[model samples]
Target: MAINIMLATAMQPLGFLSAGWLADWAQPHTSGPGRGAALVLLASGVLLVVWGLAGLRYRPLRHLEDLVPDAAPPPEADADLDAVQNRVLAA
Candidate 1:
């Protein structure tokens, strides 16, 4: 977990740098062999980021909440129990 956090912190800046580079590469009035390669990179990066976020959508916190009960706070748990009891009685 610690290593993953550290690596992410380091790599986070690289993503920004890559975006900056791509923006510069594809800036208006610039022409070269791969005229739109930067745009391709931009699309690819966006896709990869979206994919990564989707993959970790439920585990960003990497906590027991994702895999266990007792996720609610104590006060909330009491309220939830009361609500359930009321529903059961009403039904």
Candidate 2:
């Protein structure tokens, strides 16, 4: 939950920064808005290709399924209040 919150908080600012960078990069080279859009698309494609190659080269990423353990099932809920209290006290 905390990790998700942190990621959500960071993503918007990072997005704005990337958008600013793309605008700065595309503005000088392109004549029109359409050209700038095309440049952004081209940049995205290149980034995707690089990301794919990186995933291929990284061994841990490739073996992630084997490395990480599956989550344990949750404990069953106790209905009786006295029994629950006793278990809690014992623990």
**Model 2: residues >4 Å from true position, as ranges?**
1-5, 77-91
TM-score each candidate.
0.33, 0.56
lDDT of 2 by residue, 1-91 (tens): 5996999798979867787578667877989766766788788789989988999899998898899998875454436777877988999
Which lDDT values do the candidates have, in the order given?
0.72, 0.80
CA RMSD (A), model 1: 9.8
Q: Which candidate wins on lDDT?
A: 2
- The TM-score of candidate 1 is 0.33
Per-prediction count of colliding residue pairs? 0, 0
Q: Model 1 lDDT vs. the true structure? A: 0.72
State how far residue 45 of model 1 sits from its true place (Å): 7.0
Provide the lDDT at 54 for model 2. 97
